[model samples]
Target: MPRLPPVDRLDLDDLVHRYAVLVDQRAFTAVGELFTPDAELVLPDPPTSLRPTVEVRGRDAVIGALGRLTGFAATFHAVVGRVADADPGDPDRATGRVACEAHHVSVDEDGRARDLTWYLHYDDAYARIDDRWLIARRALSVDVIATGPVRKVRADG
Candidate 1:
């Protein structure tokens, strides 16, 4: 049990916010800088094109796995909410739930960008180490997704 630094509270918030922004923007390499050496990322139903239920361990593997998403040129949008719990023993260790709705878009043969939406929830574990806060693990629960003829455009409009 390590005493949390006074400034760590702010770091925790920034860490969560960064996750939302970086992931959506596909900043895979840059995102790596936010994590500790031994980080883990668990993605459930990561887009159809990617392997669903992927578990990435270690900083490099996590970053590499996320990097794969860029291949499709699709967006991995995340909407996070509420710091459910944080380990008081270690300000670097916390648990959170994030609500997310993801959408992927690409040009159809006709060259019109077709969009699809997915709804899911994220259960996260976070840890602070070396004066940096990082995601320890993330468990994703998929609620529903729109596919085939039911896909809708992203709200970015």
Candidate 2:
């Protein structure tokens, strides 16, 4: 297997880290900058949740979906590890696996509060565009999730 240039590897690694930073900062719009115009994102549905798998295509949709995180009172994303390989046939392309943990805090309309954390793994494909590394495709799988240190509401009126 041909090795990727050190600079390319560094740039791609930085790209992965920046996604977490941007999400944690709620700089969702900025997240779009890390992807190609036609990038794709596939997210698995949570266990026992009614929602179907999420598939977002194109940078604009990605930005819109991420921007909705503004509803959360707080969020933090940590990318813990990654393994990447550059394509020998296409030096400008690479693939990797990333592990992450994300915590979210939010309140429902009924005034109940919850804190949730998800352990996730990501499969990613990166491409160089205009000399910048960008995400071309990404699929996230949820390995585990813990929810609710629930703030229960007492019945009284």
Candidate 3:
């Protein structure tokens, strides 16, 4: 298959980066716009967390699932890298692997805060619809987790 067009490649890259930005901003509702109506998101069960593997289907469900991040005081997701290509027989379809580092901050009952970081990657399938690129399916795989106390510093505006 021919390489993905430069414009499509950039668009896919921007699409993934938008996910990181929206997630970090806790804009779960707006994030739904980046996905297809029937998109799916699959999350692995982390070794340190008791949560089972989670599979959410549909844009609404994906939004609801992302809202769980609100349990943390804050989260920062950095998109480290990504590689994507057009499907062999379909220019409107593509697949990619995106690496990310997600940091979650949580304050305990006594007011001490800690950071839990997950080094992970997403295997994504994308589809172009109505001249826009949207994630059709994404499966997250966590490679490592690190937890430590954090001394947060803030400045008043």
Candidate 4:
């Protein structure tokens, strides 16, 4: 098995970071470009909830789901940490875990401003497609979630 090159590792890191930037910019459609055509996104059900998990396949479906973010006034996704490695026997295949925090500001159904933050970790499987690394599968695990009214506090105190 050949060792993974440093350049490939950096490219993987860049791909993870780029997702945050694209999502923050509300470029939902463009997000699909970072994934393979048959990619899948698996999202766990919220803690203590009876809701079913989110499982979506195909690039178009992924883009459509992200487009739902229009409900939020603003959103920011940051990749706080990541660890990835190429498969020892298959250089084109890799696996990784990414820790991220996503903040969303939106107006509730009643019109009040609400702030929601989700701390999550993504377990990812990547594949080198057409000379570029793209996500083939991703499973998101939620660590913590917080919600509250959007408040303004003076910093001059």
Candidate 5:
């Protein structure tokens, strides 16, 4: 397969980065704009505390599922690396893998807080629609989960 053009590669990278920023900001509404109308998002199942074996289909469903992130007091997603390649036979299609470190902070009723971090990667499929690249499918796989207590520091202090 021929490599994706420099511009296409950059656009794909921007798409992935945008997802991280939107999620961190809890801007679920804007996040939907990054996906195609029929996009799908698959999430892992298991020993992790996250919802298990979930598949969210379509743009609206994806946004709705992401809304669940509100359960966390705060969330941060950092994209560490990404690789994207154009389809061998079709320039309009592509695939990518993005590695990320995601942190979810939760506060207990007693005022204690904990941070649960997931070291994960997203396997993605992309499609060009009307000259713009959008995520068609994304599957998240968690490589590891680290949990620890956290102390909140006030900035004003």
Candidate 6:
């Protein structure tokens, strides 16, 4: 067996951490900045519960989409598994996949609690810009989701 290169290990680890931080913190702006200019995020074929194929072009769109996702007020992301897979020919660019569990916290009018369950898979591309790794493309695949909390909703009078 041969030992992996140290630079490869560190970059891979940093890439993983960057992804974790953005998703965990609902930092879409940061997420959009993790890829290359021509990066493409492909959402694998799946069911309706999961989002269909969405191609987000350019950093602004990525940032916009993220804003909409985070506009709800509160969201939590928990990513599982290693995220360094799609190495883009060059060390400066790469692709990867990550499994994530998301907890959404929303407060409706009158301060009512609204919660939802989101199971997701993120396919991403990363590029090195200005000596920093950034996300270029990101596509989301949702496996299972519930619109309401575990408890049944009570009808309002």
Highest-lDDT candidate: 5
What TM-score does structure 1 among the candidates reach?
A: 0.73
Between prediction 1 and prediction 2, the one with superior lDDT is 2
Q: Pairing residues by index, what is the TM-score of model 2?
A: 0.85
Candidate 6 lDDT, 62-127, residue by residue in tens: 666556655455566676664465453566666666787776666677657666767887766656
Q: Estimate each model's TM-score.
A: 0.73, 0.85, 0.92, 0.86, 0.92, 0.68
Q: Write the per-residue lDDT of candidate 5 for residues 27-120, one digit (tens) a residue.
A: 8989998999999999887575343368989989999999989888888899999999889989899999999999998888998989999999
Indicate whether candidate 3 or candidate 6 has the larger lDDT: 3
Lowest lDDT block of 10, candidate 3:
148-157
Off by over 4 Å in 1: 1-9, 46-52, 73-80, 147-157
lDDT of 3 at 55: 91
- Which residue pairs overlap in candidate 5's backbone? none
- For 1-157, candidate 4 gives per-residue lDDT tens digits of 3446899889999999998899878787778999999999877666663222698999998898778776777787989999887798788999998999988888656767777888888999999988999999988888889998876322221
Candidate 3 on 1-157: residue-level lDDT in tens?
4579999999999999999999988889889999999999988766754232689999999999899898888888999989998899888999999999999888888988889999888999999999999999998988888999989723110
TM-score of 6: 0.68
Question: What TM-score quantifies how close candidate 3 is to the native fold?
Answer: 0.92
What stretches of model 6 exceed 4 Å from their correct place?
A: 1-6, 23-28, 38-51, 86-89, 129-131, 147-157
For residues 6-77, write the lDDT of model 1, one tens digit per residue.
576567667777876786777777787776667777776545623237777787887787776664436657
At residue 70, give the lDDT of candidate 5: 88
lDDT of 2 at 3: 65
Return the clash pairs for model 4, or none.
none
Error of 6 at 26 (Å): 5.6
**Per-residue error (Å), model 1, residue 25:** 2.6
